[model samples]
Target: MESSSHQDSVDSTPVSYESSQHSQLSPSYPRAQTTSLSLSSTPVNDQAHNGYSSPATSVSPQPEEPFKAPSPAVTRKKLSGYVGFANLPNQVHRKSVRKGFQFTAMVVGESGLGKSTLINTLFSTTIKPQRLYSQPGSELPSTVSVESTSADIEENGVRLRLTVVDTPGFGDYVNNDESWKPIVDNIEARFDAYLEQENRVNRQKMVDNRVHACLYFLQPTGHSLKPIDIEFMRRLHQKVNLIPIIAKSDTMTDEEILVFKQRVLRDINYHQIQIFSAPIYDNEDEETLGENEAIASKIPFAVVGSTSLVQSAITGQEIRGRSYPWGVVEVDNEDHCDFVKLRQMLIRTHMEDLRERTNLVLYERYRTEKLLGMGVAQDPTVFKEINPAAKMAEERTLHEAKLSKMEAEMKMVFQQKVQEKEAKLKQSEEELYARHKEMKDALEKQRLELEEKKRRVESGRPLTPDRPSVGQQQSQKKRFGLGK
Candidate 1:
């Protein structure tokens, strides 16, 4: 009985061990199998002998399953929480503010057109000092001279480097035929300087002294553009952003200004001069579109520039304008002048646009022409942006055309070879046919001669010619009477 009980216990131990091993091999029963193996390794009699509780009684029957890995095909997911990446505009704004900005503007017109005053009024600061003419007896300058003034201004912690280029003695001469030459030369010189800097090895500290915008102040003649104005603009329009302004517009009535603007525009159109206008974009809001339109409607802006403060009679407010006996012309008043609109477009709205156009359009054109003059040629496709799909299609088309050309050449060669072979074969066939016909005719003539010989033999005729040769010849000679 004791041996049988021992045998039964041994058999039960192997069964439990095998079950634990099987459970350990299965993925879903890892933890439960580990616990069962640990508990089963201890003997039950040893636990009772040591007065210790069996660990199997405390073990759980089932254990939680392990986590499975996600599927490889799963890509998109609905995020339950936020992850921040929406501050790009703020970052750009901060960087731009840290870098600051720079702008260069050129003012071109005749003397006493209030160019200096207009620049001062635009920036709300004294940019160019008032120029004092020489005494009445002193000689004036023979030609136009370019004057440049620079200032660093700051508004709300944003710093700006502003440069104003003034052209003096432009139309003051009686023979102002070459007045635009000096200004044009100066602008080209700036472009050359920039190109030189670009060609240098180290361009880190390059200065941008290129003139971006040119404000051409038109005289309030209540007529059309002057000859000098037309010539100057025609020369400089391609090099700079041309902004036309009517100086001292307060002198002309609103009706006169309107008619004068029309005449000036007509002249500009007739001369094929390009003036700077605000660019309209499709994505702009309605307000921006309307604002741009309003600004454009006031082109060739008629303006009155005054730095003096005058109290308005109606508003009882001090405004930057000139006081007159009859009425005051406010510089910031839109109804009185287009000074505010001009300032808005120049400084507030289209400042960057002006710089961009100058660099991209005007400067690039000049650079291209200069390089071409210097014998430096460039491929038209260089630095040009191309769409990948279009490029692929173009390559495919070229490949197809090339294949077609090769196929055509191959077909032409094959046809020529075939024709030559046919001609050779025909010649050989004709030669064989002619040789066979000649052999056949020889055989037929031989047969005819044999048949005649056989027929003569059958009829007992002489086989050889009855030429008793010498005797027959002598007899014939005698009969002919002189052969001897």
Candidate 2:
């Protein structure tokens, strides 16, 4: 019976099932026949030669059809879910690329949102002790401004110099002040020089626009655009990429953050920036990035957040509380916070843009200064206060190093004066936009009233006056200008 069963298994396709002792025991045995028959159903064993031979003798009948694999369900899962692979094959070029894209930035934000704090922390040094202002009603200056400070720190074998610009809070002073202007004017002036490009840049880049980037800081308060912040941005919009940063994010709730983002999207016309909160570091981006991280990180976080390779330092296995205690705090609703997100965004997405911008700025500086040689054209003025040789080499562009410094000086001296002017200017603009809106609303209302009056008049009733138009006063003002 077994022999018959084996015969049935081999069928037209003969599968040879062998055992070392098969010839001794069972060449003729029924069990041997059964084994031969069932050979087709068994998995193929790897042969000594390791390759399979064609089943020309037809050892096994093919299953009714080849095994059909299960179909994968479509879902929203992103490739990022895969670790390591999510990043990319060994970032072999990345290490060198990271070396290539070290960036530096100096940006300012609305005061009190911890811009300065972030800068100091990133650098792991005290930039300038933030002057604690005696609460209002006290005699102390609302803020003792942190003297501008910058330094070079080595991290993970990379040397980066960071200059943190701790700008005093704008638009928040309680008293009537005119201090914002000259500083703004100076910034506008420096920016204007870059924009005007009468000089200071290559002809190719000298197109009407200016400045490689301008990162605007927005606090975690509400999304309502402050008149002053909007004013500042509008002035620089034509010149720089307006990056709006969200500071002190730890203070904001998730809902608030969403509302803020939506509000900014609706209110501000520029592209929604890499909006980030505190504790968020610039992360590395791959696809659109040109390898390295952004130069702006070398500059200041208040100015820009993540750049390509410039990862934020989270508390890692090697890091301890004394080193990065703050990393313990929650951010963006996650217990395990990753500041690197912000860093990666800036570094990867904007890295090339940053490097190109920096190099261009350097070249422009060199050409515009028109120095014949370090020996001949070197300005002694830059070196007087330091080791002359070192200072000379360090600050050949000393004049430009004072770019924001010059602006700040103007602020220090004329803060009150500028504040007064800004107020007037602000009032004028508000009056203008508001006046136009009012006129538009009034014109529509008046036309409707006129129709009503005409309807009543057509019916033979009396027409009443549509009241004084807003322009009645403006007409008076124009007459004043005419008198002038």
Candidate 3:
């Protein structure tokens, strides 16, 4: 009676009333259609309610939609105020300044070509001191050797680590056939060092020892390039940045220097030897473009280097140049020679460009060849970019193909099972039919015998006359004494 009364009270309460009560308790919460709310006035009685029936109410949950990723199209946004990210250049500048910079330069030429003087003049420092020749009757070095010098220089809070590689005794031998081999081997050795560092597990302290520029000093002979010059440039051009310089240009007149530069360029072009030139960009300003163009126009620069300052012939002002009886030739004067242009391109403007070209072009080419020679290959798709949509589509296609194959296999198995079942049922039906026919034939034969016996009884004929019984045959044998 108590259970009946409790069920009656529950049925009297409407769902709307319960939902209103829940909303009054928690008004901000949203009520979903599939949500169930139950209220019990007392404890559940397990004995009163059958175990099959639950006391709580439950609602089936609706299936939710699958999540989709956002589109990959880039969206540009405009900011109203200056953000700190705009100062990224300043941050990088501070970091780079704090870390400092490093650069390596190589100079290759024969002895007494003023290579040491030119290097000292270029950097405005005694990086390579003047070498003292051996005394008379001393034996000379039979082979060329490479020498390197390093210095740390700082100016206005910025520091630079400069390395200069010098090739002495080059082109000094009587048979200078293999003079360039040592220089080439040294450059390759630097490249190998850098490659080894890159392959190391800890690369945070990796150093860049690769050659960035090669300054090949040319003899001021007032003629075309020699076979040795052409051969050296041709062999070393691919390995490093080649900057051909006409050494000791004060020895030749202006007309002769001009004619010699043309002839040297002709020979270089004829031999297809590449030389480093300043690169111009489309977005550069007019001043920069003009400056780069002027720099490029003075390729194969004719230069003179001197540490001592001399007075100018016209201005009477002290300048860096050579003192001559006829007139003073200023090293910093564009009218005198191409020294100022060479310095501008090499140090003031294109130093970073040289480093970039070496790392991205020259070093990369050498590394590729080295790796290929060592049988190291890279997959073409290793660093390839992937599109999310395209990748998803490809995966979906593969999944659909797999599903199709599985479905075909299932259908084939089902058909085979159905065929086997049909064959078994057909065999069973044939066997049942044969058993029924045999039973019918036996029943018909029994019915005919019964009719014949009834006919024999009605006609009053002796049933025993058709076939004698075994008891009657035994009695006749005993009577005739033939039973034994």
- Whole-model lDDT per candidate: 0.74, 0.42, 0.74
TM per candidate: 0.64, 0.37, 0.64
Model 3 spans with C-alpha error above 4 angstroms: 1-78, 379-484
Residue 9, model 3, lDDT = 10
Ranking by lDDT: 1, 3, 2
lDDT of 1 by residue, 1-484 (tens): 0111211011111111011101111000000000111101222221221232222223224535533434459578777878655678778878867887778888998889999999888777677789988999898778788877777766655667777888889898888888899889888888888898888898877778888889999889876677778789889888888888999999999878876676666556556677887776768899988987788778789999988889997898887899999988888778999987898788777787787777777888788888899999964444344556667888899999999999999999999999999999999999999999999999999999999999999999998877568878888889999686
Report the number of clashing residue pairs per model.
0, 36, 0
Put down candidate 3 lDDT per residue, 24-102, tens digits, no spaces: 1100000101111112223332221112222222233445764355667998999999878989988988898899777
- Least accurate 10 contiguous residues by lDDT in model 1: 26-35
lDDT of 3 at 242: 89
Task: Provide the clash count, candidate 1.
Answer: 0
In candidate 3, which residue pairs get closer than 3 Å at backbone N, Cα or C atoms, i.e. clash?
none
* Model 1 residue 76 CA deviation in Å: 13
